[model samples]
Target chain A: MEDSLVLVDIGNTNIHIWEEGKIYDIKNPIAFGEDVFYISVNENKEKEFLKLNPSALNLKNVVNFDTSYIGLGIDRIMACKAVDDGLVVDAGSAVTIDIMQNKVHLGGVIMPGISSIKKAYATISPKLDIEFGELNLKKLPQNTQEAVTFGGIGAVVLMINSLKKDKKVYLTGGDGKFLSRYIDGVYVKDLVFRGMLKTIKEDLREGKK
Target chain B: MEDSLVLVDIGNTNIHIWEEGKIYDIKNPIAFGEDVFYISVNENKEKEFLKLNPSALNLKNVVNFDTSYIGLGIDRIMACKAVDDGLVVDAGSAVTIDIMQNKVHLGGVIMPGISSIKKAYATISPKLDIEFGELNLKKLPQNTQEAVTFGGIGAVVLMINSLKKDKKVYLTGGDGKFLSRYIDGVYVKDLVFRGMLKTIKEDLREGKK
Candidate 1:
């Protein structure tokens, strides 16, 4: 029964669905049965999905975690919930770095993702409209491409390193694998799904669902 | 005679003119007499200014610097020229951090300016359309505003601090004063102009101009 269960995450840009060890990213909500559970940061997409299947459970209703961050996105909360300790980095449209210690959400910072940083550079000037290349943070950049790339990727890498002191790091989101090359971290693509599943299991054990 | 000379910097967004002890920011190029030396990153604006005063000295022709970095901006070069030993940070449309020691240019990195970072956040998601507030780098941000602010400002600060070691930092550009409050540096508004003047003085002494 657990293998058949569908988990959905509605984000700003896409709707991600996971089922039976397979993941799918869709622009629109798919037809799911009553056994589906979902989390959404996009309100309009949530409403659209709910219209298709009103019985689908919203994970936000079932999951609970200790966090002091007010107005934090549910997506971020779910990512943090999966980690009992260490740093959680979700690098997609926006990069969120959350710290979890002893099952408690310490706090996190948000940065523009790789593509967003690229777009920001292009917006600043036509000369900066180039793709970011490999950067060695040990040495300063000597050329424009390296300079911009260092600024975009190096900033994130340096910030994570600054905060990571002796803690394991979990990487997720679209750019996670790419960032993993620069940062010493484990790439967990299904981290959010893991958090949702863990929450459901806890909820079931307590006879709450 | 030095007091009557005008120094203009044509940037992507505005034309900055430094005359005597006063600086002026204008959208359009102003009519200046022959006693004008200017550096420009905007080709269109440079053409417009040259149309009015053909004999006006282009600082790029007179200024010389020792550097291996190719395709480096003239404005950045000018900023670096003013300093013999230190980090030169020109935080305008783009935050350029260049390292110089013993009158030799080492290298640098470029990060988006504060406003560009804000725009990048907004472009990622409308929910992130908020002003960056003062950040405490010691602690992880808890809220969205703080998170975004910390990411924007904290990243630059951390990068600068990491590279600083024992080097003195010089801050210039539009947001130089604001950044000075965070980074231990002196804000010099006329840094680029000073570089240009120094170059012209050297050229005159060598009978090259």
Candidate 2:
């Protein structure tokens, strides 16, 4: 399966190019460029990608869906299309857990991202501007940060436990490894980008069906 | 019918003492002069109130509850007990709307406080600070603050309209006047505190049955 195709993953904060089995980080350009097919799950990014890559005049070959699958984010749609009966948890700007049974979309919950949750207490309450530390699974958190970390991780672990009844849970993104320590499930980082490539392959194979 | 009795209204942030049709602002104190039966909703305040007025320890007349009842706040309970059938909208720290059908309690919705909603955007995104302004009823909101204000008001209007099938809607709290302009329901700003006073009269007659 030797295919010479360039897949551009436009995400919430960053963009990546998928060539062969390697992912190359690319700067999100200010204008649309030729020889680039843009796929993004974020509406804002999709608009920006189109504005920058005016060459993306028609999305006839491009698809947009958020990770939630209610719409596509390059990361989410890719994650959904990439797995088979596996759970993909994107612990990025927002912590989203997407589960696919036989590669069909099953909804998941959206919670405050790790940093977002940490910033919540700090920004909302002046007394809670402390740095959050790693969660100790064996003991209950004593302070506010520890409590937040414990609760945040507990939420993800609970979600995984709920889905683990019949599937394997895969982790990805910045907070995935941190979460993996508390989660009792299989995890694979860097799957968000891979899922994007896989979605492109699927679209190509099915002839844009 | 003229009884020389003083009524006290305890709230989350302030206290109001009603005497001779006039309301006086009173800070919850650890000690108060004679003829004052100190009462408060805050556990800490209640302890101070008892210490300030020794009679409050043996009075068995102070009333309070936490955020668990159908209408927990003194204002909410007072408002609910005031009207026979109507919708009660409390626009305080949080905006909550509940329905009373012939004095029966129906469920309500709890949403972000009006001020909090506008503050949320700024808190989450440091660059998007906005100050609320006077609302124009005839036109749609164009800016962020206006949008949030409209949203906050719209949510209450929607709920009131949805629940006003067979009941009159009543508005209370400091923001009641502001909200009343955006809604078609009746506004009674002091309904909660009034209702609490009425309850006290009834309980005194019934001997705390």
Candidate 3:
């Protein structure tokens, strides 16, 4: 068994795993030698990963960061490391834009996520009552549902445009993939996990520094 | 039906009513009379009121002010007329403090409302989940729930203290009643509706200036 390293990418909706440079779904725990990369929101799943092998405990490397911090989101940090200098957009539970220049983060904006946008519209204006997914790019939505989707996506896209300045753009998160196709930018599905791994490795090395 | 008048008071949470010189629940239609006073959001509820008396639909007066071009909630206009040179604290879903000196609003703050305060804690620190009612005046709460409530109220109280300057304070809204007791001010629940009625009467008599 090699030195077990657990890489956990805790997100609003899901936790991702990257062990030996491979993504593993924690729902089904597997024996990945001494190096076990794991991430989860559900306590039972995390415990399951830990119990994959009793001997795997001693060499376990765990990294945890709370997502509630104002300037820090796991995904944001991950995007920073993934791109040297670019606009990183995470359209997850909320739409956030993190700007980085020369590997240094330049603060970002926190707007209503895709769902929250629809939720707010429906909530604030009862006349606009509709669901979130109903939003899609239409020249002009004939119905309220289509109109709402267009409205919500339009607002977010406009916001993203406001944040974008001559730089490579990267999109991540569940909503990110869906929004990426419509956006003029690069898309990285595993950006958060990859960023976490990079940050962990940096912290570990900086400990020596 | 002696020249029936509709009064509308739109606040953060629910719109209020002042019909025929009496306060009524904005949701209830019976509280209305002839001559429509469609003011702010309550215009949505007025349709129900119209059903009761067919004669009430004689004049539909929609109070339309450019909210975008001008930074004012309809409640502020009412507050301005109801109380001369007073500090109006509309504490509903969110706490807003507007000061009017000589019948003119001097701008205000859009700090997190009590609910938003509770929400911010949950959003920024979801682990400390708690409700507003549970909050107490404590320096340090022994538990997470108390801590959340304490922090939320403390923040509002602190903000009010900073913004307050010896001026007549008037509190409105349902939640405003709860907060009024804690703050150094007077409570005028019917101010919004009363103000709207006053505005309509003035506009009707004077003709839109």
Candidate 4:
């Protein structure tokens, strides 16, 4: 792998760039003079970035994985690829939970992310427009803010915990650290980038053959 | 408790009216000639309904419950009032889950209801604009639609069940019957009205005293 190789993960909201062991989240697509590899969920942003850096390779085209799930997002596939035997949770605009056992994908489920859940409540009623704060999961809420906050965060925590069982759980994405506080899981900020790098290295080895 | 007494539950989306054991969900507020008693979460709708029927009574003004929860929705309180001992799952635009033991309110959490959850997913991205269908909770989903449906519904089901423990669960609101299928709970469609009637009767007895 070239030292200047850049790994980009373009999502619905932001463009995440990984370069030289550093990560940066930019609002809009930016040009890169260096060799770039990307997996994008946003078609428009991908196209915009492609126009600027025409030589950039989309990792989705080169990377292959063993998964039966159809229409699964490439970002999710990449995250799962990084894990050999664990549950991978990609918590961004959407929280996706996928499991991998002995190098085989065992499907997954998707839930709204924390901010999206908060926005959903706000859309339902103006009175419910409040930020989620520190809460005690053992004690039930006694106010609207506590109720909304607990419900929004608690459900996600409980669902993940229930599905976790005895498996090793891997957490990634923007809200990964926030969820790590509640869930007993390893928070890997660069899991997706690691997956992308691994796939690129494997592809290079195949080219030599 | 008069046969002519009309009980109305004004929510964010619709106004549910119960009269003579029949219930009606109307988009616009309607005037009733007979004595009307109501509990409303929507302030504007309540004001509009009051103009249509000048003598209409707001049940929130009269009905009282023993609860430490501040800013608790009156509709949720009414549902809790109907059940002496149980976890009340009021599944509407916002699914409010409250606990009542020996006629005492024990606080609860709020999560997005079925439709709101669906809309939340849709709002996150256009690709997730599919409708939720029947899903098997035991199995992880292998498709986008199934994954979303499972996550959206499964989280709520698990949260309610976890809180329920050995307590009886009472479901009400629009999606009460739908949730009843997954949860081992009794579905009472007019739980709010039952509560309203109960409070009205109690208030009348207190007035005579």
The candidate maximizing DockQ is 1
The Cα local distance difference test for each model comes to: 0.90, 0.56, 0.55, 0.89
Tens-digit per-residue lDDT, A1-209, candidate 1: 78779999999889999988799899998788668899999999999999997989888877878889988888888888899999999999999999999999988999999999999999899999999999799877989999998899999999899889888999999999999999999999999998988888876447565
lDDT tens digits by residue: candidate 4, B93-209: 899999999989999899988999999999888888898888678998999999998889988998898899889999998899999999999999999999998888876447532
Q: Is model 2 an incorrect, acceptable, medium or high docking prediction?
A: incorrect
How well does each candidate reproduce the native contacts, as fnat? 0.85, 0.01, 0.00, 0.89
lDDT tens per residue, model 1, B122-147: 98888899998997898778899999
Candidate 2 lDDT tens digits, B1-209: 32445555565666766565676676765444444533355566666656656653211243322222332444555667777677777776556566566566554433334554445445443323556566553443344444434333444454455546677778877677778877777887567556656555565445563
- Interface RMSD (Å) of candidate 3: 12.3
Give lDDT tens digits, candidate 2, residues A117-156: 5554455334345665675645433344544444344444
As for candidate 1, its clashing pairs are none
Candidate 3 per-residue lDDT over residues A2-110, each given as its tens digit: 2356555544445566665676544455545655443344455556656764454211133332222243544465666667688888776656676677776655555
- Superposed by TM-score, candidate 1 places the C-alpha of residue B74 at a distance from the truth, in angstroms, of 0.8
Task: List residue ranges in candidate 3 displaced over 4 A.
Answer: A1-12, A19-31, A38-48, A53-71, A120-127, A131-147, A197-209, B1-27, B31-48, B58-209
Choose the strongest candidate by TM-score.
Answer: 1
Show model 2 residue runs off by greater than 4 Å: A1-209, B1-4, B30-39, B57-71, B133-146
True contacts kept of 4: 0.89
